[model samples]
Target: MLSGKTLVVAAGIFLLGLVSFGEAIMGGSEAAAHSRPYMASIQAVEGDAMKHECGGFAVADQWLMTAVHCLPAGPNGRKVVLGVHSLSQAEDTKQTFDILELHNHPQFNPDNYDNDIALIKLDRPFNSTEAVKAVAFLRAGGVNPDTNAEVETAGWGSLDNLGNRPDALHEASMGVVSSTRCGRSDYFGRKFTGNMICAHKLCPDPCDGPHRIVDSCDGDSGGPLLYNGVAVGITSNGGKKCGQVKKPGIYTIISHYTEWIDGVMGLQPDA
Candidate 1:
């Protein structure tokens, strides 16, 4: 049976005199420009070092969607880097934005990872281009997708549990598993809530050839779980060891919070 452990969310509280958890890039390969244009790299800049904390996505000219745990209330020296493919090199297509406001959900429960979503308002609007684009949300009241549907997860975290962070963005294919399966005795069990989703990594047949044991870990928090170009989930928590068999990565389901998100973004509830 699984122990009741509060699996650490990717980025620790940085702006509040807290420690920053160095985590990310587990089980994904380099991503291309067109693959995930809405992707945003959230960072904390301190003097000479700029650290990648979490991943987010633009939903509007001045609004972004991310995990509440990524940002603790109060001020922080954080920014969002968009339209870039590499973290080490600055490309002409890249643009940076200063975070003017962080609107974490009012009812967010950190103890159980409930309402693990938040929105970021940019100091200025992003000039949309081919490299930088806003993504559509998972429409409200949509039918629950099939458990077998492929979910594409992207981030700049680590490649393994205790590995080094990747210099480039990486993406991987995973499959949505039944919450019942994910909540089995061996998994999170009753700790899994309705707001959470579970995705299992796909391991290739080593006997045949190349196959990645794709699963989110370390620094993938706040990243998106995209389905048909819509972000349906956000990376939340997972097992202690990423990519472990039967230890699926959990995400915050977006559909359940569309009304809350709409309210925060000042859009119609049904919009």
Candidate 2:
């Protein structure tokens, strides 16, 4: 139920004169090195260089999750870089892997951005290390966080409206916004779906207040939204400009897709 207005994809390449709907981290601080072991950087091979495209996180030994929009053309030139805190440094803990397969949600709708989740299979299982590991995720029938619950997200996306990206990963704390509130006419309205979750720092009036807002912006697509040490959502989309009041970053609820994820990963369902 996206607005009739044309929408541009975020966290990746953008065409001129298009407003981006996806987002990255704004008003966040640099994350401690190797603190977020599950974080993954989805990079695209641009000629001889591998450029950062989106954020993702490991869910299992060889599987990571991201937004389907992050790999619109499939995984032809995509690679997953794990255990990387700084993109500029040659970290000894970095693990790079070729994408073995990509499993996008069968019912994904690009127009409305619904069911935006996708899983990437690595060519080989990850080697356990201090800076490389998988994180826990929400299971089917698990309790979802309540409104105002504190959650966190991290990425290497632009830090502000001018598109200032960072070499090191950054993280921010935000509060969950109820679907009812997020779906208000002034907010996302019909574009916000049940399968989606939203989070942001509270700002009564962005235009009038001096408060610094924290949110995901361009280049943060496909990242994890962690709550209570578990990944409950996947970064999907947001306002044209990040950190806007009443325009929280939208995410694909992981609990809603556990069955599909289990089937694709060949894991037994939780009893």
Query: lDDT score of model 1?
Result: 0.78
Q: Which residue runs does candidate 2 get wrong by more than 4 Å?
A: 1-26, 203-209
Please report the TM-score between candidate 2 and the true structure: 0.87
lDDT of each: 0.78, 0.87
Tell me, by lDDT, which candidate is best.
2
**Model 1 root-mean-square deviation:** 9.6
Q: What is the lDDT for 15 in model 2?
A: 35
The C-alpha stretches of model 1 lying farther than 4 A from their native spots are: 1-27, 206-212
RMSD of each: 9.6, 8.7
Give the Cα RMSD of candidate 2.
Answer: 8.7
> Tens digit of lDDT per residue, candidate 2, span 141-208?
88888899999999988887778899999988888998999999999889888999999885433322
